[model samples]
Every structure is written in structure tokens, then in C-alpha cells.
Target: MSDALDRRRLLGRALAFGALSVLPGCNYDNLQHPDFADRALRAMSRWNDRVQAALFDPHTLAPTFPASAITRPPRFNAFYDEAHVHVVDGASWQLELFGNIAEKRPWRLADLRAAPQESQITRLICVEGWRVIGQWGGVPLGWFLRRIGADTKARYVSFRCADGYYESIDMPSALHPQTLLALDFLGKPLTPPFGYPLRLRIPTKLGFKNPKSLVALGVTNVFPGGYWVAQGYNWFSGS
Candidate 1:
């Protein structure tokens, strides 16, 4: 419990620092400037991502937990607070597929449900240094990609969410067996606060990589930096 509290405190401080670093006066882009601090930080972030990518084993699965280990009311997280959570209307929801795909169409909730589906109890490790276990059910991301005839050779798979959130993942992680276009959590349809309709559940990546309330998914070779990534967070935030 004390460790969790400590992690929470560290996360709070990190978030505060990130917020300040991106303020109007802060110039993170001028790496050649005399202030070497920002340059060093950016270098470290890139190094971390490279090392993780080199060490990543696509076949190795993240550890799963028993039902008893599942966290009750999994902690809610987003760029905004709970009150600002995007409320998606199920009746009007349609998922757009574009980019390097052979088929370009809008998918409804029924379309996803009809695909091959499975469930897993996995941990969601946050960049904030905390983690929680939850049961998520949906179609395997790879299966869905193949079903859509997507360009599997693409370097990245990116997502756009209803709440103005966006994120991208490397092809290896996107094809991982544990990665899911999650439609349900804890055996029930996801609620508004928890990203209703669809969420990306990736046990191998940090919480931020798992975007919520997905409105569009694209396959591309170009890097589509996420909301946090644009604000100087690491792009490949693998767990």
C-alpha cells in the first residue's frame, strides 16, 4: 500500500513537470540551445524506446491473473478528469477504417462483435508507476486487421478516439495476441467512464498506449504521435 502511494506521488510530480515543460515559454524544440537539459532528456527517452524495442519478444505474453486478483472499479484515467469523459452514443457510433487498408468502410458495433472474440485477465501498467488487473474481452487485433485486409507490413497502427485522444503503436505490438479491440470489461459492456463502445487493451504497453472510445483506426508507415507523445512523452511507451 505504501509503495502504491509512493508511486502515485511520483506520478503526480511527473505530470506536474510535464505540464510546466510544455508551457508557452518552454522551448523543447531548440535542442541546439545552450540548455542541455531538454536535449539530454529527449536522448534518454529515445534510448529507452530503442532498448525496449530491441528486447521485445513478440511471442512472449504478459502475465495474467486469476479472477480474484482483478481490481474492483479499475482506476479511471485520461487527459481530462472524469467529468469530462466522452459520452459516446451507441446508437450513432461507427468505427472508421482507413490508411493502408484494402477496405475503407465504417464499422458498426455489430461488425466487431461478429469477428473472432476472446477474453483475458491482464494487468494494465501505467506510466504513472501503478498497475491494475482487469478482464477485457474483444476481437484479437491481428485477426481484425486480417479480416479487414489491412497492410500488415505497415510500420504503425494508429487510433483516433471520440474524446479527441490519439495514439499509435508499432506493428509488432499491434499484432500481439494479447492486444484487443476491447468491447467489454469485467464481463459487461464498458461504461462511459471506462470508454464505452471500444477500447484498445494492450497488456504489453503502458496504460496511455491503450486508447479509449475509439472512433477510427488507421494503418500507416508514417508515425502518428499520440496526444501525450506530442507533449514530449515517450512515443513507444511499452511496459
Candidate 2:
């Protein structure tokens, strides 16, 4: 609906600056391999596949929680640029999709929410060593794929966040009945602090796997990057 923010230039600058200012405990390194700099970008995407297979491999779930528990929200692990007027102001928000998707797209939040919807109470685990059970309601990603007429070749769906986060998931994870593009929270409109407008919920993985304040979807066969992976968190974070 809106134009994609050409943020590569500015975001690149910020990432460069971050390499120095990362807080004391942060790794500030890309898994530091001899070939690290040359192929560091694939960390998150590769991990995404590993976890996806573990979850919906025509097998058991990665892990599932009981409905008796209600999540009270885990420690916020997002990096939101409140000042990013493009998302905060809602004047410039676009969602992109590529890869085997026949209908290349750029959708607005309103458009994404208008699609089919579903809900569930699931446990969310964070890589920071905590978990929370929460009720999430949103549209199933399969609806989006069907609408786009995705071909078999399309294996990975990539989401880029407004805060400069990237996450990729395999085709099954993208189409999983539980994977939702959430528009509401706890029976109320999601606030900006909690990935307002819209976010993705991949119940099978840690909370960090879900990208918040999402702006674009690039469906591709290639593994895309993720925020934590570039920082040395296990790319295939599935335990």
C-alpha cells in the first residue's frame, strides 16, 4: 500500500555504529569464523530452517503448552525505533513478498488484518531464559500464501521489521495453522511497545523468532538474516 522505506543506507550506518556501542555483554561479533564476514548474513535464515523442520516436519511440535496457563507477556526483547516515523506515524508502511510467490506484494497493515484470522493460547519461550503463556489471535499465514498462489519452489518466507530486524522461516512454518499475523493483544489493540499494528507469532520457537512491528515480507529460497543470529545467538535456536 505504501512505498518501501529505502532504509539500507541509514540502517547500514546505524549497524556500523552499533558494532562499537553494543552494550558490554553483547558479543558484537558474527560468530567470529575465519569466513565469518563473507557469509555471516545467513546465520538467522539457516537457523530458521533447522527449527522449522523440527516443528512441522510431519512430526511432533517443537513444543506445545497447556491452555490452563495464561501468558503475562515476557521481558520485552524488541529493538523498536520509536523515532522511526515511517512506522510510528503509519504514513509509510509496506509489506513485501518475493520468491516462489506468484503475486509479489506490498501490503498495508489494514490489508493484512483484513484477511482470514485465527486464535490460540500458547506458551512463548524467550532465548533470554524465560517463558510466558499468552492468548494470540490473528490471521493464519497460509491464507496469505494461498492468496499469493505460492509455488512449490517458494521455501522460505522472510520478514523485515521496522526496527531493522530480519527473520526467515521455512514454508511449513509459514503455513502452519498456528503461525499468525497478529493484530490484537489480550483482547485489546496492541500498543506500540508490543509490536503494535501487526507482528508475527511462530508458536513453536522462542519469542525472539517472532519479528515485531513488521514492515515487509520477502518470500525467497535463499536464507535471509536475523537480528540475534548476526550477534552470535544460535542460528538454529530450536532446542
Candidate 3:
């Protein structure tokens, strides 16, 4: 049998043999069932998430590079090709707010720009084993979170994007100083192929966590999974 099939069979047997009992709130029967194997995989993913979260340091910052190190012609990445990237109208776009926040009003581009901005030259590490360094500038997310009176104690902060992508981060990761609602890339406003208007630029996590073309944001205690995460990518995909 193929190695991939062998691994799957091993995982199924592990679940049946109680190796998946380490996962909290999940019960597995001692039977070799297809559904049991799938649940076992999910349980393992959740366990990995908890381990990464425990190892994460909220105060530790990701390494920053000088301007000279910035990658030229920054690599454009998405689930879709650049030719199919959705163009958004910056003038008509509004960042809607929801859940556990005192401010429910939508914020426009100008409002976001008015906030104090920070710039960073940081590396974007992809889970596919590629990395690129680029310059990004925007309002610090932690500052904005406080400005909106969001309950920082909430467990998760979720995002909705123009391209139908959705993602969520832990509260500690959300409050990381390097996390930004990035509006500028390479000292210029983002273009359509990039995350025009606004995007999340989280240096500490893998590239997929930095979502593009943000349309909505919310703070909640409930779990809000991501597009790739639902397909079995690690939710706490730390660098």
C-alpha cells in the first residue's frame, strides 16, 4: 500500500486503540470506523493547537529586517491565481465591526488611516516551506482593539474577507504588538492583486494567517475556524 494510505490506516488503528484519548471533550470507540478516524484526526489537530498556544509568547516579537532586506517584487500568494483576484472599491468599502465590542459602527479607510501607524520589515513564512521579507505599514491591531473597546479577555478575534475567506486568531495572538491591520505594502497603498484596502499582517504566524481584503472583524469567545483550517491545516500554525 502507498505510504499515505499506510499512515491513514495507522491513524485509524491508533484511534481505535485509544491513542486519541488525549484529546479533551472527544470520545472514541474501540472500533475501526471511517468516521472514527476522521474524528481522531480533528482531535489530534486540536491537541496540536493547545500545545502551540502554550508555547507561544505574547511579549516575544518576531525578528525584523532592515529595508535593504525587503524582498523585491513581493511574492503574491492566495488559494487562487493573481489573475482571478477580486478587486475591491476602496471608496465604497467599510470595515464592519461585530461581537463583544462597544463600537459597532463601520470604519472607513480614512478613519483607519487617521490612527497612528507603524511600519515593519518582516518575513512571511509559508507552510509550503517558502519565505519572503516585505515592508508593511498600518495601524497596530492591539491599539485598534482597545480603541473599539473590544473585550480583550475574549478567546478569539475573527475576520471576514472580500474573497470569501474567513479566519480567527487567539486573543493573545490578536494582542501581539506586531499584528497590524496592514494598509500599505512597500511604502504604497495595496493594489488589487495584493490585499487592497485592508489586510491582517501577523508576523508571528504563518502566511495563511495574514488574510487579505478584510471586510469585517469581530471579537468573540466562540471558536471561529479558518478556510484552510477547516480542511485540516493547523489552526495555531505558528512560525
Candidate 4:
């Protein structure tokens, strides 16, 4: 418990520094003032998000690598150890869609496999500073969103995972060309440890933004805070 508290405190301080660095003329000398500090951090975080979004170029693409650049025996990461990885039954798995979508129907694995497929060899950079290059193939999120008649202008696209992890991304990032509903990894269907059946494979953001074993997706204007974002990480963590 002490270790968790220490990590949270460290993260809080780092975010406070980020807030101070971006917003000039802000006073936060008294760390004892929790209320004031919390308010300042919230405001600064939102401001940082706006700045990042404004600077993001929809036309620009993340750098991609060749097949040879793929990481061998890809690294497995999650809140749980590999031994505890959730095993999703691919045959029984169905993607549920709701909120601002005209087609509320569930999508089966066959449906996704039959859709137009795109593949990319890209890097997945973790916030912890490790990165791995891998090849992923799946449906383009932009095309899928349009096909389902989702509100393209919606502020947020939220995802619920099989392992209880949840995340959200802005509409622009969701519609980015590199954003994919990844079905295959390393030229084959994903194994249980790597989010089998369906996972998001967005190269534009950090690894956590690319949720695995996606069960439900929703489009909404309401702010859908992610697992890590709720724990103080920046919401718009653009790579």
C-alpha cells in the first residue's frame, strides 16, 4: 500500500510541475494547500489538452517501419501478470456498440474479418519509456465509424475492455488514419495474452490508449475518463 501511495504522490508532483511549466504566472508554492492545488492542476490539465489538440495535424501520419523492424516475441504488458491474462473466447466474443450510433447491432469476429482490412508496422510507446515495433492488421476506425453512422463530431470515443480496463480518445484521434480496430498481430490472429479477438491499435497515442479485447464502444459528448487518466495521467497523451 505504501508503494502505491508513493507512486501516486510522485505522479501528482510531476503533474503539478507540468501544470506550472505550461501555465505562466501560476502560484503553487504551498503544497499543503490541497484544494487550491487540485483546482490548479485540473485547470492546467484541461488547458494542456486543448493546446495539444490544436497542434495535432490530422493530415500528418506517425512513422511506420518495415516487417523486419518488428519486435521478436513481443512484450506482454497489463495491470496483471502474464499468468493471469484474460482469455477471451474469440468465437463467442462480439463487439457491442452504443451511444450516438445508428447501428446498435453487435459485431461478431466474422463480421470484422470480412470488413476491409489495413495493416501497419508501427511502434507502441509506453509512458514508462519502453517501446516495441509490431505489425497489426484490422479495420480502419474512421471507415467503421462512418459505416455505423456514428456521430463523427462527437467529442469522445470510449472503449470498455474484457479485462475491466477502459479508455477514451478524442474524435480526431479516433478518426486518425492509423487508428485501427486491430484483429491480427505479427501476421496472425492475436493470442489471448495480446488481446485476442479485437483490440485497438492506434499508433498516434501511447500504449494505454490502444485498449485490448474491446467489448463495447460508445460515442459521446460526455467526458469519459480513462483508467490511467483518472489516476492523474494526461488525457491527451499524444505521442
Find the candidate with the highest TM-score and give its number: 4
TM-scores of the candidates in the order shown: 0.85, 0.70, 0.86, 0.88
RMSD of 3: 5.8
Model 3 regions more than 4 Å off: 1-34
- Candidate 4: tens digits of C-alpha lDDT, residues 170-223: 999999999999999999998888999899998999998989989999999999
lDDT (Cα, tens digit) per residue for candidate 2, span 118-201: 777777788878787777777777787788777645767888876777887667667767788887776665567667767898
In candidate 4, how many clashes are counted? 0
**What do the candidate models score in CA lDDT, each in turn?**
0.85, 0.65, 0.88, 0.87
Model 3, 1-239: lDDT tens per residue?
Answer: 45434433423335355655454543333224435556767789899999999999998999999999988878999987899999999999999999999988999999999999999999999999999999999999999999999999999999999999999999999999999999999999988777999999999999999999999999999999998886568899987
> Which is superior by lDDT, 1 or 3?
3
| Best-performing candidate as measured by lDDT | 3
Error of 3 at 23 (Å): 20
RMSD of each: 6.5, 8.6, 5.8, 4.6
Residue 49 deviation, candidate 3, in Å? 0.7
Alpha-carbon shift of residue 157 in model 3 (angstroms): 0.5
Candidate 1 residue spans exceeding 4 A from truth? 1-35
Clashing pairs in 4: none
